[model samples]
Structures are given as C-alpha cells and as structure tokens.
Target chain A: MSGLLAVESAGALTTVQDRGRAGLAHLGVPRAGPLDRPAATLANRLVGNDPAAALLEVTWGGLALTSDTGVWIAVTGAPTPVEVAGAGRGSGRAEWLPAGGRLRLGTPVTGVRSYVAVAGGIDVEPVLGSRSTDTLAWVGPPRVQDGALLPVGAPHAPPAPLDTPRPPRPGALRVVPGPRADWFADGALDRLCAASYVVGEESNRVGLRLDGDPPERVRAEELPSEGMVLGAVQVPPGGQPVVLLADHPPTGGYPVLAVVHQDDLWQCAQLRPGDPVGFARLRGA
Target chain B: MDVLDLRAFGPAAVLAEVADSAAARSLAAYARAARVDAEEVVPGARTVLFDGVRDVDGLARRLADWTPDGGPERGPLVEVPVVYDGADLHDVAARWGTDVDGVVARHGEIEFVSAFCGFAPGFAYLAGLPEEHAVPRLDTPRGRVPAGSVGLAGSWCGVYPTASPGGWRLLGRTELTLWDPARYDPALLAPGTRVRFVPV
Candidate 1:
C-alpha cells in the first residue's frame, strides 16, 4: 500500500509542482513548476528519489500535516522551521518523519517559498503532461484540502539522510540578450546591468514585475503580442522591467531586454515584494 | 493574397503583420516553415517565433531554400461542429450588418487553418473569418472563457480547447477536446491541420 498523508492545513499559494511541464508551451501551456529548483531537488534527495519527484510547493511557507503511515519526509528551502509535536525538526535541512509524527512548517524567514517532499512522491493525475498546479488554467487535478488524503508511492529504500545544506551565496543574477535585444536605440543593455532593480508586489508565479530604478526604453511604438519565454526581460512603454517566470504566456508584445539564466532563476523565485536585485550579463554562449 | 508589412522582431522571432485576409495566408506560409522538427517555432495571429539554434546565417539559407506545402491538402481538413449562439452573438451579428442566422451561414462556409497554437494549451489561432464578420476584440476580455467556447477575435476565429482568460467574442460551443494529456495526440489541431466549421 502507498504511504498516505492527511492534509491538515495548506498555506497560501501551496501547489503541487514537479520539475516542470515541457514541450507544451507551443500549444499555449506555460511550464508550471517549483519556484526553487535546488531546494526541491534537495528535498527529493533526502527522500531517496529522483530530483524531479512531485512535491508540495508551499509559498510564504505555512504547511502542516500528519502522516497516516510510516514514511520518510524532508523539508527544504527558505528558513521555515519544522517541528514534530512542538520539537524542532530543523530548518534549512532535511529530517525523517516517523509514522503518526506531526509535521509543521512555520513562516518563511528570508525566502518566498519552500518545498516538502515525502518518501515516494505526491501521487496525482498528470494533467496536460504535468503535475504542476496551474492555478491560472485550473488544470489543478487536486489541491491540498484539509483532511484530504494525499496518496504516496512505493516505500523508500533504507538510506542515510543527506548532508547538512549550505546556504547559497547571494549574488547578481546573470542574463542573456533576449530575442528583442536590438529593439532599444543604443546602450540599454549597459544600464540594465548597471542599476539595481527591486522586485514588485504585482509579481507571482506567472512573472516578476521589477521595480527599483527603471531601465530606459529608447522606442515608444505599439508592438504586436509575440512569444514570451521564462526569464525574458520585457520593457513595456513605461520602461519598468518585467522578468518572465514559470507559467509565462506563449507570447508578448514588449521588447525583451534580457533573459535570466536558467541556473540563476532561483534568485527571481526567492524575491519578495521589496527585495532589491541586480543583473549580470552572461557573456557568449 | 495581399502581403502585409513584415518586421524583424526577436533575433529569434519575426512578425509579418496584416490588417486582414490576404496576409493571413502568407503569414500562415512562414508559420509552416518556422514550425519544423529541429527548430522550435510558435505561430501567432500575425507573428511567428523561430527560437533556439541561433544560427541566423543558417536560418536565412533555410528560408532561401524553402518549399511551400503546395496547399492545405498536405494536412487533413478537420470539420468542427459548434452551436452558433454565444454571449456575444448579437454584438457580432450587428457588426456584420446581419442577424444572428446570417452570421452562422457565413462563418460555416469558409476554411480556417491552424495559424498558431498559443494563449493557452491547445488554443489555436484560426484564420478565415469572413471580412464582414471580423471585429476588434472586446475593450475588456473576460476573465474566464470556458473550454470549447468557439469565438471570433478580430479577423481570426478559434475554439478554446482549454479554459482561460480571453477577450474574443464568443459565437458558440463544441464537443471536440483539443487538448488531452493522456491521448496519443493531445492537441486535435496541429499546424497544417485544416479546419472547417459546421453549425451543429
């Protein structure tokens, strides 16, 4: 029988996400997945499974639950402290959750999201080639409703827990010149890396609306909506930078200034409403 | 067919725009080439995306040595039956200087092609709406357009394979499921797949 866990309380923005939906954007399905990839990867490693295993993506970090059977569980990402029966389960690391043990994820300390991984994986019907919860599309096969039993997979093989996680060094995110890089009159790329940009409140899983000092736009002409990619830095008429993210539409009309590197995308995912950020140009291929 | 203004967009994507009809066909032509096996291409109402493998030199050569599909017969012409009654029926009818019944007859007569599939999963940019039936998008698009709700947005018309937020004026509904993950062919409409409307 699969390990089952009952959902007690799911935090705001909690959604089931895996590696991501691939090869489907052309049909208009945006890739919906975890904001923090390495964290999600770490969580899966703690449970002895593939890094792409389905995990519960909890944003603003407040998830609580109880396992219905004996199973392994690990919590990763952010500084959301975990506990079993009021005893600390550790934060920024992974731990085992015995059967009938209570697991609680407190508020996030610095990051915007965290992921909880079970021994197997979150067993859910794959919709449109993904287990990612696309709230915008309502293709969510199921949500973390209280008392709803979450189905797990085969038991994990006996193994030692992962080594203590070291925090990532915060640095400026790197980006490649976007498809519409030349739309700007001249030295727009220079100013993009020169100035620090802040994350805006209007941002979500769809895309990040960057604030801070604005990037100047040389042109002010109407643009037809064209294909948009994740990490694409599109400057609207107002010159405010919009960094596309997971769940981004297939197309947009704005001129793309730059594209954030896939490896550095986690920085954009961890940004809060007022977090300041800087861009670094990724040279060459 | 009238050729529209072609503009260079992303180093990866291009836009061949037209005010209406004659250009929709030519735009569809480039869309066919852009959407080959090796290259990742996405077609829109008027623009097409040619992304990945950033060999601008190779792309120019490929286009220079290109061959058209001859005609729409390369792909099967799929007929979609839909009810010609939507929330925007009256509004669309008036724009065409006709009643609701007249709009249905004209709409069903033309052949529409899969110009592109974007906006949502399996949602296609279908061209071939009659000139008179064409109208601009709504001032404010509806937050949720139900799946299978056939509608016309400007000179283009298409079915909502997946429910999403859109501004197209609806004319009816259909039973064909365009997107299904489990199915061998998820999207019923593929580029080059021909489309014809039938009033159900």
Candidate 2:
C-alpha cells in the first residue's frame, strides 16, 4: 500500500532513519542510523520492507499517527503498548491498520528507543544516500514533527510469519583495548572493567556519558584531535568515559581507553539514564 | 619509504600511525586515490583510520606494501576574502610580536592546505602556519562562534561552518558560505584543497 501517514503527535523525539550515511566521516558527517539496529531490522522484516528502507525511530514512545490507506505496521524494541483505532494490538508483529485508523503508542516499558515500520518505508528525501537524521550535524531529513504528512513508499513482499523474539543477552559488555590505552595510568583497563557506571542524564544520540570512577590518566599532554569510530570508549579529562554512538563526532581529542564490541553496542541504545552498566575485556581481542 | 604502525581500532577498523600531521594527510590521500578497500579513510593529527574493512589483516598487509611517497595532489585553489576585525585579532598581534597590519600581511602570504575536517561539518583544519607562529587556544571557549569566523589554534587555521561553542583564537571573518546541505558538495573546503586568505 502507498499513501500518506499523518503525524498526530511526534512524541518527545522522533526521526526518520535507515541504514545511514557511511563513507562520509572524513567530511565530518556522522553515520546517523537507528541506534538499535537489530530492533529496526526486525521491524522492517515484519512489515516486508526493504532492509535499507527508512522507518521512524521513536524515542520514549507516545507517537500517534493516522493513515489514509490500509497498511501493515510493526513496532519493535523496548516493548510498548500499541493501539489502532483505539483497539489494543501486539507489538513485534505485523498488524493491519485500516484506512483512517488512528494508531498510537504508549511509553516503552524498558528501553529508551522504539522502531515503527510500515509496509512501505517512510519515503523522506534521502541526503548522502540515506534518510537517517544526524542530530549532531543536523544533516539529512528534518525531525518528524506533529501534523507533518510523511509519504509512504510502495509495499514489497508480504509480511514475514510471526516469530518469537530473541531474549536479550545478559552480562557485562565486551570491550577491546583501544590504541590510546597507553595514555591512561597503569591497570586503567582493569579499573574500567571493575567499576559499575550509571548512565548520565546528558546522554543522547551522540554518546552514552557514564557517571562513575574516572579512569586515571598518566599522560599530561593534550592529545591532538584524531579520527573517532563507533563504540569508542573515550575518557575526557573529567575521567568519565563516553561511549561514542551512531551520531558521535567524526573526530575527538580525548583518549580512547577501549572500544565496545560491535554486537554489544545495541544494548547501549536501550539503556535508560541512571541504568547501571559494566564492561569486561574481550578475550583474545 | 616510512612504514606505518598499524594498531587495532576495533573489529572492523585499523588505526595506522604516521610520523606527523603531514604524513597523516599524505597517507589518507594515497589511500583514497588507490581506492583502498575500506568504507572510510580518515586522517587525523597523527593517524589515518581505515574503518569498515572486511579483512583487517589483508588490508594492513596491502597498506604495508605501499609507500606514501608524493604529498597529496594540490587541489583547486580557493581564495577566501576576510574582514580582519575579529575579537582576538589584537591578542594574536601581540603574541606574534607585530602590529595588526603586520599580522594580516603574514597570514595572507601563506598558501594553506586543507589538512582534514573535524569539530563541525565543513570545518577544515587548514595547515600552513609555521611552528614559531603557533597560537594558543582561548582559556575559555566562547559560547557561540559566528559562522564564517576564521580562527587559529596551535599550527592550524579553520573557519567555523556553523555557530557553535569554540576555543580557537579568532583572526577574522569570511563572507564565503562554509557549509550548505543543499549544495552538490556541502563543504567549501574539502581535504587537499589549497586555500589563500585575501584581505578585502
């Protein structure tokens, strides 16, 4: 189905996102894709949308929308209450929303981000080959606003059969020692793995700022700005480590102590402020 | 030919350490020109980061086999007109041990290279200032630096592409549009572009 999805309420923060703009970091452009990759991928699969098709990355839920045509929709990540025409519908599976049906979402129960996928993806104009919004650089399509009419693309294949969602893995996040690990004090890596850090309130798409014992530094000289990467555990002079995310700056001056394993990075997207987290050294990294 | 010290950045990338910023720029330029099998070839102050390489070991071996001989290709020259009335112009003059006019003349004479882009979109780290003329950053960063404000920190010069907090010592303001998303190439100063500051 292809039509328009009118936004009734855009919630706290909502933006159109897809696979994101890669190969542009050299120009200082951030790769602004969905923070929770697996969730977004699942949402698209459930609705039969192309893997790279754009979707809504709804933060803290509360998004309300109405469609002009019947369409298959699916919600994934941080299980939240979904309603269509004032009737309750289950998340993590495709559900048909009739024409003129009002669809609404409640606050998520656990995670901080939620993904909403329509049979046809959100067809916003792509910048640098993606529809994802880079909050840091203000690149790509504008943020989804209330009363905005978002065009939906033509649907492809039929929705996938409903499957049980995989349970979240439990344990400390795995990390590999960064190149600048020598900039920190002796045993700094051990200290970093030992301490439990709480997510700071200042956290956003750019990074997850942690509040805990700052890793001690041995070097006093300032580090010249260097290229940064996704999941870099950069520690500022203040000592708190900020785990770089999808929208992090292309370069930074802080010393990176470790890089979180790519597979474990999605967990950071769902972590709420004040949530306790810990890290462990990845063996044979 | 100097060898690069390659270090593991993460699972998908490798950090190649170079001798200095000049070598870093050269390495990045060579990698791009050679069409290195990587998603991004990024240049920093003293490192070139190759990210999204499927086979890190193979890429490292290939990189080791090559040498960064010639410097980056001299890109098209872009002349930027400036109004030399920045907030820190006097401070910079005092530090350079010259009058305001002398500072302007010295800055205008050098042809700077766009070393790399960082800090903000379209903001290029122009390298040309001699080591003796290096300037220190402001003790405290300004809350908002106007767009098109040309500033110097240490041995590098840059134009603020957008209004944001910054600590670089302002030398002047340029009327040129540094960044525009609608343009075919958003950044006015891509890496390797040669630039000259002309006093208008």
Candidate 3:
C-alpha cells in the first residue's frame, strides 16, 4: 500500500523524525530524533517498517491525515484519543486505513508527543542522512503544515507480529554524577534527587527546563564552553537545572550536575509541563 | 606529547582536556585518523569530548598512546568576503585605538584556523587573534542577529550560520552560506579548516 497522506491539520508542532543524524556534533549539528525512542520503534515495528524509518512526531496531538490509498498504521507514545472517519479507535495495534479514510488524534491525556507510523514510513527527502528535523538549528525539512502532502514510501516487509504490551513509563529517572558535579555545593545531586521538580513551560525538544530549588554553586568562576551530551542535567547561573535533549546545543558553558542514563531519557520526553519529576542516582561511572 | 587528562563527561562520553586549542584539534584529528568509532568527537577550546564510545577502555588506551603528528594538517582555506559595515565596527576600532580601516585591515590580515564549532551549527570558533586584538562581548545580546553576520566574542571570530540571539560584537556580514545540509560539506568552516576574511 503506497500513496500520499494529506495533512489536514498539524497541531502545535509536528515534524518527520527518524533515528537522527549522528556524528555531526563536531559541526555543531544536534542529533534530532524522536523523543520517545521505544514508542517510535514500536510504531514502526507494528507497521512492518524499518525501526529507523521516518514517522510523524505529533506534539500535543491534534494531527489529522487522510490517505490516498489503503495503508497500515500504528499510533504509539502517550495514549490518546484516536478516530478513523469519526469512529473511535484504539492505538498500540496496527489498523488498516481504507482509501480516503481520515485518521485523527486528540490531545494526549498524560504525555506530550505521539508517534504515527505507516507501513512504509513517511517518505520525505532526507537532510544530512536523516529525515528528522532539528528544530533548534532549523535544519532538515520544514515542520509539517496544514494541507501538506506527505508521500508514502513503498512497503516492503510484512506486518509485525502482535506482541505483549510495553512496560509502563517510570516517574523516577536514573542518573549518574557529572564531571562538573564538584562545581556545585556538596549534596546538590542529593537535593536534586530528593526534591521534586515541575517541568517548565519553556520546555521543548531542545531541553526540559525544571522549576525547583536552585542548586547553589561553590565556585563562582565561569567554566569554559565544552561539549554537551544528551541527557546532561546542566545548571546555568540561575541554578535551575535544564536537562538537554535531542535538539540541545552541541556544546555549552553551564556546569552539569548529573546526566540521566540513556535508558531513562524516554521518561523525560513524555514529561508534560507541570508534571513532577524525580531522579534516582545510579552507581558506577 | 603527554596524555594531558582524560575524564568521563557522562556515561556515554569521555572528555580529554588538552594543553591548548592546537592540541585539542590535533587530538580530534588523531581520533578521526585512528577510526576510534565514536559517534561524535567534538573539539572545544581546550578539550575534546568523545561521545558514544562502545569500547571505553580501548579508546582510553589509544588516546593515552596517541601523539599529534606535528600538529593537524591545515585543511583547505575557505575565504569569506565581508562588507565591514557591522554595528560595532567603529566601537571596536575605538577600543583598539585604531580607525575603522585599521580594524578591518587587522581583521583581514590574519589567517584564522577553525578551532571548534559550537553555539550553533556551522558557527565555528575561529582562533588566531592575539591578546590585544581580543574584545569582550556586547553588554546585551541582540534578539536576532541576521544570518551571515560576522562577529567577535572574546578571542574568537565567527560568522553566524543562521539568524539567532547572540552576544558577540558584530563586525560585518557575508553572503556565503555557512551551513547547508544538502551540500557535500554542510559546514563551510569545519574544524582545522583555515579561514581568511576578505574585505569587499
């Protein structure tokens, strides 16, 4: 099944994404990928597509699309209200979209972004070897807009076999101490783990800004600009922590108190504004 | 050549603090030449961060034994034609106790090597200026500096790849695209590439 998917309405921010463009940080290009990796992978798998195939990343839902031909699709990430031609439907499973069928998604009840995957994936022109869009740097194809037509790739593999439900997302993210942890007053990491932080409204793919007690700094001297890694819990002069994400700058000058483990980054992606966040310290460097 | 210092950046990255920007660039060059298999090797002012390494121990051993081969090779020169009509052109000239033409001449005389890229994609931190030539950033950053606006901050001169909020003192503007994803070389000023600013 292959044809065009017409974008009726793209709510908030919607962009095509894949596994991301890697090894380009030296050029200061960020690795822009889906926030929820497992969700994206599962969506692709359910539709019998390559795990890294580009898919529609719908932020705050409200995405409506109509296919020109029959197609298989699966919606993953924060469970949300879904409908096919005004008929209520469920996600986490593949469903056939008949020709001219309209698929609509409502705002997620708990999460921020949702993934929509078709059998052959979103066949958009790639930039820097990845279809993912870097919102921070304005790289790759422009963000999805209303009335845009998305060409569907040619389907190759059979539909993925049905599998058990995925594990629930955890509230406490695991993290390890950062190299600049010493720059902060002792027990800063402990305070960060013990206290709860609410996600700031300014949060986006670039980073999740946290609003809570500011960690006091022991040294007032400035740290030279250095390479930043994904999931780095960097503390700016304001003392609040900002967890770097997919669109974070390749380098920064702030002191990083800790870095969340890669496995726990999905939780960060699903986090909604005003949602509480807690950290669990991990042993070993 | 000494092993300098190697420290863990995060679980997935290791940062090597070299003696200077030259050493930092050389270390990044060595990593590229040796095929270290890291996802990204980012060189900074005086540090090189190796991210997404599968074999940390093996990489550490190789870096410890590695020596820069008489400094990294200077890649092809990228000439940037600039119109010296920046907002701070007169201010920078006054700070240096020189006239507008003198400031432009001094800036155009030196050949800068791209030491690192940061802040924004293709925004290379070109290093070559002497201490006296270095100038502080603007007291307040502009909301949106136009793309290709050449600027100087501290000891580094860079051209903004895209329109963005910046604190650097604007010195001029260029027509050349600093970053183009569709091009074979996306970043016009990749690290180690020599740069010469031509006044038009």
Q: Could you tell me the TM-score of chain A in candidate 2?
A: 0.98
Off by over 4 Å in 3: B68-73
lDDT of 2 by residue, B76-167 (tens): 89999999999999999999999999999999999998888898888999998999999999999999999999999999999999999999
Judged by DockQ cut-offs, the docking class of candidate 3 is: high
Could you give me the TM-score of model 2 versus the true structure?
Answer: 0.97
Docking quality tier of candidate 1? acceptable
The residue-by-residue lDDT of candidate 2 on A55-143, one tens digit each, is 99999999999999878899999889999888999889998988999989999988889999999899988987889999998899999
lDDT of 1 by residue, A1-285 (tens): 487887788878678888777666566767778887878888887777677779988888778888877677788777787887568877544466778888888898888888888878888878766788875555545667766688887755643385655468678888767656667857677788889888889988888898766666666676656666667888888788988887778767788878787778777778899998898887762
How far is A264's C-alpha from truth in model 1 (Å)? 1.0
Per-candidate TM equals 0.85, 0.97, 0.97
Candidate 1 residue pairs in backbone clash: A179-B10, A226-A251, A226-A252, A227-A251
lDDT of 1 at A164: 57
* lDDT for residue B198 in candidate 2, whole number 0-100: 99
Top DockQ model: 3
The per-model DockQ list reads 0.40, 0.78, 0.84
TM-score of 1: 0.85
RMSD of each: 4.2, 1.6, 1.6
State the displacement of the C-alpha of residue A158, model 3, in Å, after optimal TM-score superposition: 2.0
